[model samples]
Target: MTIQKTISLRPYPRGFHLITSIIEMQLAEIRQIKAGILHVFIQHTSAGLTINENADPTVRKDFETFINDLIPEGYAKFIHNYEGDDDMPAHIKSSFFGNSLQIPITDGKLNLGTWQGIYLCEFRNQGGPRNIILTAMGA
Candidate 1:
């Protein structure tokens, strides 16, 4: 069996946020898939998706710091400044982290590591509500 749904997340600040509960809450259909794969695709360029240590808030904060340092804003080298100083850097960060994730599903639940969780890497200061497409496929 296969199921797909588009989910929208509440607006978050410019940082990395854990959204595992939000996704599970909205995608209740995943409970029906005994064994399968869940593909999550974010629908935005200034923000992206990833999975990492969910048990530590510092990890998320460090992610933001590291990314910002790696792709600092106001470089004066980016031509896509129509949005703002964060525009170009946001796009670069999005590409670096990617916009999608594929996780294994077992026993009607995501087979994530004990400390792993999905993340929404909001690069822009006010990257409004983000959308994600969840597709689950299995028996």
Candidate 2:
């Protein structure tokens, strides 16, 4: 049989980026399921998920810079600005990326690449609590 669990995270950021509770959720799921696959997802339009190098802080910084460069703000071409300046941009970044990821499970553990770690990408610029939904399913 398979079971699913949902976890939430309150990220304090407006356009600040952060790597969220994927590791902790995965660890807990592994303890419950003897063997199977794990799927982690974020239920937000302006947020995303990715697997990246968590060892070096610079890596994350570089990524933030790169993402910002890819989608610079203050564009008169944007239409969705109801939330704020960062709102439309956040949606763009999320569109460029994704909202979910699936990891393989083996021997009651997630089989991830040595340098691969799950992260929740926040594109909002204001520092406030953000919600993230994690769902895990396995036998």
Candidate 3:
């Protein structure tokens, strides 16, 4: 079986937000596949998708802090300043974090680690709504 769909998320501030539940909620078709792989791709350039620690909010907070420090906004060297200081930095951050994820599906559920979860890394102060494309394939 195979299923695909695009999930839209509400706007969020610049931060790492846990969105595993949100994705699962939208892609209920995954449950029908006893074994498969779910491919998630973010359709925007300024944001990212990743899986990481989900038990503590501070992990997400620290992710934002460390990444910002690594690629601070308003860097004098940035040339793509058309959108604003955050624009170029957002692009850089997105590149580092990436825009997609592939997770194993077993027994009708995501086979993520016990402490793992999906995150939507919002790079802009107001990235507005984001779109995620989900593709599932299995027996």
Highest lDDT: which candidate?
A: 3
| lDDT (0 to 1) per candidate | 0.94, 0.69, 0.94
Q: How far is candidate 2 from the true structure (C-alpha RMSD, Å)?
A: 2.5
99 Cα displacement, candidate 3 (Å) = 0.6
**Over 4 Å off, model 1:** none
Candidate 2: which pairs clash? Answer: 11-130, 13-128, 14-124, 14-125, 14-126, 14-127, 15-124, 15-125, 15-126
Between candidates 1 and 2, the TM-score winner: 1
TM-score, predicted candidate 3 vs. hidden true structure: 0.98
List candidate 3 stretches off by more than 4 Å: none
Expressed as tens digits, the lDDT of each residue in 110-133 for candidate 2 is 777787777777887762454455
Error of 3 at 54 (Å): 0.4
Candidate 2 CA-lDDT value: 0.69
RMSD of 3: 0.6
Q: Give residue 128's error in model 2 in angstroms.
A: 4.3
How good is model 1 by TM-score?
0.98
* Tens digit of per-residue lDDT, candidate 3, span 29-75: 88898899999999999999999999999999899999999999989
